[model samples]
Structure formats: C-alpha cells, structure tokens
Target: MSDSVLLLRRVRERSGEAAAAAASGGASSSPGPAPRRKRGRRRRFYPEHRVYRARSSFLDLSEEQVLRRYRLDKAAIAGLCRELGADLESLTGRSHALPVAVKVTSALTFLASGSFQTATRDSTGISQSAMSNCLAQFLEALQRRAARYIAFPAPGRPAPPAGTGAFPGVLGLLGSMHVALRAPSENEVAFRNARNFHSMNMQVVCDAAGAITNVVAKFPGSCPNAAVLENSALARLLEGARPEGAWLLGDRSYPLKTWLMTPILFPCGAAEERYNALHHQALAALRQTRALLKRRFRCLDAAGGCLQYAPQKVCQIFLACCVLHNIALRRRMPLEPPEGPEPDPEPELPLQAPHVQISSEARAVRARIVQQLEFTVQMSCESCAEAVREALRGAPGVRLLELRLEAQTVLVEAELAAERVRELLEASGRRAVLKGMGGAEDGEYKPGWGAPNWAGGEGGGQTGPGVPTCVPVASLGAAVAALSGPGGVRGLVRFLQVSPQRCLVDGAIDGLQPGPHGLHVHEFGDLSRSCDSCGDHFNPDGECHGGPEDEHRHAGDLGNVWADADGRAAFRMEDSRLKVWDIIGRSVVVDAGEDDLGRGSHPLSRVTGNSGPRLACGVVARAAGLFQNPKRVCSCDGLTLWDERDRAAAGPPPAPAPHL
Candidate 1:
C-alpha cells in the first residue's frame, strides 16, 4: 500500500460520499427532508406570471400605435382575436394555447409589413415556427369568411340603366395585375413571363365603388389576361347565364362577350365615341381599387419585394390580403399613404400612319375663333382665286384659307358677321353665296350632314317605305386559303341569313397556333393579289370597328376566333349587323393576332382593330341561290350581261338586281 494506493483509496471514498449526498437531494452536512418529488409532472416557467414577459411590449402599445403598425383599430384587433381563438381552438388543441391576442398581433405585423418570420417573431415575442403557424391559421380564417365581406349586389337590387350613372348597369370592372414571386422549382418555365420574371397574374373585378367583388389569383404570369378570364369560374358562370343586363366593363385586353363589354376599337359615330368614353370611366375604378389595395397592404406590392413562398401559399396570401382590404373598407380604416413615386405610365402603342400634324399656334388661333363661314365663290382660274384670297386677307377679322378652286369653295375663320364676309368677297368681283355657318339655329352639324347615319336608323334592315320589312334569306360561303406563307392555314367561313337583322357566321380555320385570331370580312372580294386587295373592315355604314353586338360596329367586325391546342379553330356566332346580302363577294380575312376590336391603344386600332397582318384570306361568294351565278360578275362599275337581258325582257324591272 504505498503512496499511490493511499491516493486511490481517498478518491474512491470521496466519490461515494458525493453519490450519497445526490441521492438524498442535498449534501449530508446541509440536509433537510429531500425536496419532495412531484409525480408525473415537469416544472415550466409561465410567462404570464413573470413581471416582464416577451409579449409585454404589445400590451404597452397605444391604440393609435397599434392601428398605425397593424392597420387595425383596437376594436377590430380584439374582434379578430376573439374570432380566431374560437375558430382555431380545435386545431391548436391546447387547453392553454398561446394567447389569442399574441397570435393575432404577430400575424398582423407580418402581413402589414411583409416582414420575414424571424423579424416578426422578434418583434411579437413568438418563436419563428409559432409565428408561421399563427399567420397560416389567420389567413385561413379570413379566407373562410371572405364571402361575408365581398359579394355581388343582390339580384333584387338591379343596377341602374346605362347613362344613369358613372357606370350604369356595370356590376364590376375586370382587370389583371402582376404579383412578383420567387422562381418556382417545378414547371419553372410555366411561371416565367416574356420579361423573364416569375410572377402571378391576379385578376380582380371591382364594383363601381372600388370594392373588390371577385378575385382570381392562380394564373401564372405567362398566361395572357384574356386566357385567365376565359379559364376562370366566372367565365363559366357568365357563359352559362349572365345576370340580366348586368355586365363587366373591361379594356381591350379582354374579349368582347355578351356579359363583358369592351371599348370600341375604332369610334365611328358620336354614340360609339360616347360608349368608349363611358367604358373608360367605368374601368378606371379597377385601377383605383388595385392602387388602394396595394397601398393598404405593402406586402402585395412589388416595392416590398417578391414573396418568398410557394405559388400555392402565395395565392393564399393574396386572397387573405383581399379579405383584409374588404374588412378595412367596412371598418373605414385609414389606409396607409402611398409608399413611393408611382411607376411611369406605359408607352402608347404606335399608330399605323402618322396623323396630320397641326401647329400649336394654329390650334390656339382656331380655339379663339367664334365662328366659321363656308361659301361657294365663283373664281374663274388660279389667278382669280389668288385675287380673292388677297382681298380676303386684308378684310378685318377674316382669315380665309383652304380655297378649293376646283370645287369653288372657300372657308373663312372669322369673328365678324357672316354677312360682312360675304359682302367683302362679293365686292372683290366674285359672287359669294353662303353655304354654311357656325352658331346657327341647327347644332354644330345637321343630321346626315357631318356624321352619316351609319346604321341608317335605330330599327335596322328596313330599306324604304315600299321595301319589304325583311330582306330575303341568303347564304354566302368562302373557301378560306392561307396567305402566301408556309403556315399552311386554311378554313371555310360561311354566312347564313337567320333573319332580316341577324345572320349566323360559321368558320373552321386550321393550321394556326393555339390562341385567338382576328376573323373579319374585308371590303373587297378580289384575291388575285392575295389579301392586299382586301381593303379595311367592311364598314358600309361608315361605323367604327367594334364587336358584333356593338350598336355602331363595322359590318365586317366579327371579333375574335379562338383556336384549340391542335391548331384548329371552329367559330359560330349570331350577329345582328352582318347580312349575307351585304357581305357576299367580299373577302374574309384571318389576322395573325387577336383582334382588339378597335378599342386597343394603338392608333391602327381605329382602322384595323390592331390585328396583325393577314394570315389567310378568301373571297366570299354566293353559295347557291337566286343571286348565285359562278360566271356572273357585278361591281360598282354597274350591272353585267344578265341585267341588260332582264331590262330588255321586262321593260324596266320591278326593282334593280341587288347591287353588289
């Protein structure tokens, strides 16, 4: 047993003494009854009992501070907490779950500022995982109650008639906006847009008061606006049956449907122009609603940066924000101020041809003119016209311009009396007779003088007093041929007279891409030069380009035809404006792109509806009828061989052969 052995024995005795003290719950020298062991329980620190808890800061916040930070008043916040607690009790499954107030505050803070989960947890005194849970639950609750906040007007309360208000009979205005998002890992190509950015196209329908009535948030950014609407449940509802006279107002991006009214692509008459103006005014509400929604929830704005969630979660968040927006509107909460300068406006689409330029000075001078006088002046030659112009130049308050010697007409912009100008012109040795003058008993322009009655009269298809009320039923057909290209596009377009004022157009075009294409009747039937010989849309009434249902649309405006995934299109529609008698021998042209129906932003929209180049064209010919003759050719040049024979045999026919 040397010194090493003694050291070992001392170590062992000390260890044994320490073990005995631990078993007794205290050192032997300081013993009391070992602390009584609790059975089947573990001790935990309750934050509620602490003098200062992690969530105490929320309680200390002032009412105004809470509202400013969370966009909810004290009353609203408490209500939300109560409702959420009741709804989430079963899911949470905790007799003493996290306080409802704490969960709501955390979720609201995250939603209001779009902060990360870490930041939200730090500020709200909840764990990051707990914060995520709270937010998801809260969003779910809001979505479940969305119907309570957002709804269409009741059927019993019909919207007012058109022209009665800012957006008469307009239940909602439809539009789409982009929402930024992280690139999805699966099917990433489907989420990328032309700009190479990942996003979702959120379509919203807002009422006249700027309240969002419907929202579709699942479409990928690559989806066109029109496609999104066509795929939506709302589209099915509208297609199946629309509310009587209730329609949605949209921009050119949307297709013109019986339940959805878009602006005229080209405004021809005052009535169509008025419709366009009112349509724009009504659609503006959608823009304002989007602005307000993004302003209220910075999380929804691009400025806040893209949301770092999966597409499914992103959709949920969007819907939750919409629910909150409707709630804010109901509660009359003060919205957050706009965050920064607005983005620059989109550039205007280029016009097809440059408009005639007018100098600013000329415009100003024209604005000051109180009256204009048009007169027929007898001037023998250019020398005489020069003398009359010089005489009028010296007259007081008389600016004579645009002298057409061939037509013997002179226009004078003046502030003086018309009689005085006539006297001055007559004094110059030229007999002047007033043809027209401004500020007369009649308005600016008399009926059928300035603007032609394109549709003849409101009751269409009645030619004259002795003419039949109904035009004879007729049918026309076209063998659609591809334009001079390699796309191999071909189809047939047929027109069948359904009634005097209505006709059915049926078309089947193949060898095209899957999407909308412009289908229309052109003014000319000559295909010798391909589609070039086909003039602009057949606007016999001198009307603007619009949808088939438009009151003042071009006779050839058939709107858009959609192609299936197989590059085949089949279209059938009834139009009151098109008649087989009118369109026979005309050309049916298919455009390369969707027709904007003349309401597009491009200047060419006025004339061409902004549809791209012709893809296919064919001459519309009388299929089989009294008017059908394969060899017969008639044009504005006058009747052919058959007309001469008819006149010779009948001694003046009862009525002329229907002019082509």
Candidate 2:
C-alpha cells in the first residue's frame, strides 16, 4: 500500500505540472484570459460530429443491380419519387438531410426484400434508425395516396378485360392470402392463423389480366374469408350498386351473393361439375395475378420471411406494395429473375370450417347457370337424354357421357373431335354448338372413364387418363362416295349412321365456283352421265322435294354446300331422313345453285328446289368404319385407301382455259 500510494502521487504531480505548463503557455500566447478548471472536475471533449450526406443509391448503382435490390426500374422509381417526393420534404434547418432518392431507395429495399433495418442499411448506406424513419414516411405516403393506385372500379366502368376469361359478367376474382408479421401486442391470438403464424388476411380482387382492382388488408388471419369479404369496402360498393349482370368470382369459401358467385360445395350433376371445372379455369387467372404479385414483391410471400413490423405498419406496407405493383405493370416492367414456380392455391381456404346451409337464392343462381349452359332441342326429360345416350353408346373413344336434359348440353369426353360430337347430337333433330375445347396437346384427355355412371361414382378423385384414350376399336355403319368430273373437279363424302333417325353427312369438294351448291342423294348408283344418269331424288315414299327438316320432303334432300374463293367446299351436316344403311347403294349429286329448300317461287322449286345444273356425282358404297378395314392393296390397281386419296386429291389434269 505504501509503494502504490507513492506511485499514484507521482503520476498526479506530473499531470498537474503538464496542465500548468499548458495553461501558462496558452495565457502568454493568446490575448484572452485563460479559463479556470473547477477543482475535482474532469474535462470532457468529443471528436467532431460527422455530417454524412447519403448520396442517392440510384445514381451509383447499375440499373440491374438497383432493380435486383429495389424491385423497380429507374424510370418507375423516378416516377414514384415524383409522386411522393414533395410530401417527403423536411422543413427543419438540418444541413445534411438525407436525399429524397436515398430515403426512397432505403424504404423500397426494406419493402421489396422484406428485410430488417440491418439489411436495408447495408443496401442503401443508411443507418438503422434512419431506415426506420424512411420506411415509416414512405408507408405513410402510400397510405395517404393509395386511392390513386389501389381502387375498385366504379359500376358501369369498362371492366378491365371483361368476360375474357370465359366467365361472363365477372367484374373481378376475389381471393384471400395470409401475410406473415410480428404478433401484435394486442390481440396476438387473433393474428395467429391456422398456418401457425401471426399474419393478416388480405383480400384481393384482380381482373383477368392480373391487375389488382381492390385490396382489403385490415382483417386478422383468424377472421373467415367470407367475413372479411362482408366487411370490405368492395362489398359495400357492390351492394350499393353493382353493374348490371356483373358478379365477382370467389372460391367455395365465399358465401353466395347475387353479386358474388362461388362454387357448389357438393356438386350433384354434370352441370355443377362443369361449373366448378370452368370456375377453376377462371380462377387460374386469379392465381396468375397472385403469382405476379408475389413474384415482383417477395415481401408478400413467405420467401421474404416475416416482416418485422407492427400490425398497422404491416397493413400500410401491403398497400404500399400494391401501389408499386400497379406502377410496375403500367411501366411494362417484367420480373427479370422471376420468383420460383407459382404455389398452388390451398385446396381449401382457412377459417371456413364452419358449415352453413346454402340459401335459396344461392341455389337459384346455381340452377340458373346450370340451366344456361346451352342448347335448343325438341325433346325434354330423361327420355331425350336416353335417346342421346343410345346414339353415343357403343361409339368408339367415348369416355365420359354426361347428358343433362335440363341444360340441353351433352358433355362427352371422348377421343372424338368436338365437331363429331356435335354432328352426333344433331342427328337426333337437335342442334349443338361447342362451348369450349380442351385436350389440344397429346395425352391431354385423361379418360379412365369409358363406363360412365353419369351422376358419378363414390369419390371425385378419379380423373380421366390424361393420355390419349386407350379405347378398343368400336364399329359403326358407315359409307363413302368418291366424285369425279370434268375441269379438275374432285370430291369425297362420308355417311355414318349415328342413330336410327340421324346420319352424319360429311364431305369435301374442290374446283367448284365460289358459291353454294345443292347436295342430294339419287335413287340410282349409276354416274354414267357424271350426274344426270343418277335417277331422281331417293324418295322411298311419294313426297315433295323439300328441305331436310320438312315433314313431306324427299329423303335425298340433304341441303347445300357453300364454297370459298379458293374453290374448295368442305361441309358437314346431319340429316334425319338419310340413313347410312339406306343410302349405301345410291349416288350423290352436286348442283350449281343454292337449294331453295322447296319454298321458292320458281316452278321447279317443288321438285328440285330450283337447284341449277348438276356438275359432279359419285356412287355411294359401304366403307370401313374407324378401326375396321385393314389397309390391303387393291388387287386390281394395287392402291390402298391413302393412295386412292392422293390420286383423288391430285385430280385429273387441269382443263386448258378457253382462248380469250
């Protein structure tokens, strides 16, 4: 203790001598009096307060680097700055205030990357505290001006890309997603969703082209989708006055309103199944919208991790991201390095576990759509459907046969073309138009379903074989006719007995003037005069020459074929009177003018519909149906079906044009 005390006293004495020398020298050198130091007090001094001016990150970084970090191009960012820069001014006299662009970039980095203060500070060279302030300011600005970007179009405004997704009158597609966030100090339990995370359930409505038309971000994750929709401004707007016939599409989680169409929970019929299938097809666009949203701004998805922000700030941030999304779309900015493949929608939405009865109005809307599917036919009830089934039964490649007499639309999933299906349906004195087509790619028709229990089997999980339907070859009664004529005219016609009362007449003729032609079958198979030798119409019963549909018309009055400017006439028709078996030994004739269908003023209209001079004719003969006739070389000419077809296509040498 004695030595240590002596050393401390010596050190203090040397420090006092040094301070006294400095004070004496300062007093002698300067004109001012030397300041006195209070006893027992230590002098405190600091290094100079640094003035760090944050340069604009946009200026220093390359465009690609900036877009990678900030998720917006230079022009888009500049446009955003012009939109919000005036609002971000600091009126205080701080000399080294942050530049507007630096603040914007800092805020954007946090928003796009969904990172914390540390991550944002590294990207924008701003301190953590500064970044927090910048983000708060940016979000506030977005919230105040969100109406300019995120909006629900007013009633009667051209619904953007309206009805393009094939769901008519669709104003928007409604969807909900859970956004992760820090648990709020208040109501933390409400924020924890079934996903086992604290998040806000955001309701978004998008048009067909993946543009956000409306967004609701205030609801907690625990709230049901229907409830959130109920409380949204969009609901109020729609309830007040929706456009005539307009509706919003939602998944089954949404309740059915007059203006909100949702899928049927337990679809019982083909119509309901198709409605859901088509509904899902339309929702695919909504999913694409979600894809683009999450891709451009990772903050909206789990890829960005949980946003470390308060619940209120989280809502503002969602709004802010939406604004940026729209701007990017408007600026035609593409996500260069897009996010990973899109996530499939949750098979079932959360918080909709509570069961509720479908209201009568909901049932009515469902029934209306099911009924509106399509058709005009003479028959009604299951009897008509049975008749249709009878026609398609034993038909080759017919996988799924759904006959809804009420809807009058028969859905047949088969390897056969839709045109063929229409022809088959039309055979029963009915008309069918194809509403949609699928399976354009190879193996697109998944048909493990040839034996159809129309209403369906126990589980709905079994889908068709996506590959070409592996169907056994089935047989039908068929006939074909080959036409030959002067002046390079050639043709082929096929007749198939689709049912007892219906026959499909499909054929093509080339080298005729670009106009209509009367097409009819004759009683005789002889084509000695090319067409004139084939006797009068094939009228088994004594009947007048009338249109195919007329009750007293001759059996041979099929109708007319209209040729294009290229002098090619391809035609398909269904005639109830012309049976393939009955017409197999007859001949077909083509006239020069349109058939008047026996209702014109001309004297010969009753007998021939005033059709002009005959040009080409062919003898009808029994032909191999699909999968029946083996391709044996003809014993006489050594020509297979394809070889004969090629010779017919080549036709006789073109007749020389008359000298002008």
Local accuracy of candidate 1 as per-residue lDDT tens digits, 228-326: 888898888766765554677777666556667665443322223444676787877777888776766667776667889898888888888887777
Model 1 TM-score relative to the real fold:
0.47
Best by lDDT: 2
Off by over 4 Å in 1: 1-53, 56-60, 90-96, 154-157, 161-165, 338-660
Writing each residue's lDDT as its tens digit, candidate 2 over 392-498 gives: 66565443335556655555543343345544665554444333222110011124543221122112323355422222223224677877677567777766554
TM-score, candidate 2, is: 0.52
By summed lDDT, the worst window of 10 consecutive residues in model 1 runs over 439-448
Question: Which consecutive 10 residues in model 2 have the weakest lDDT in total?
Answer: 437-446
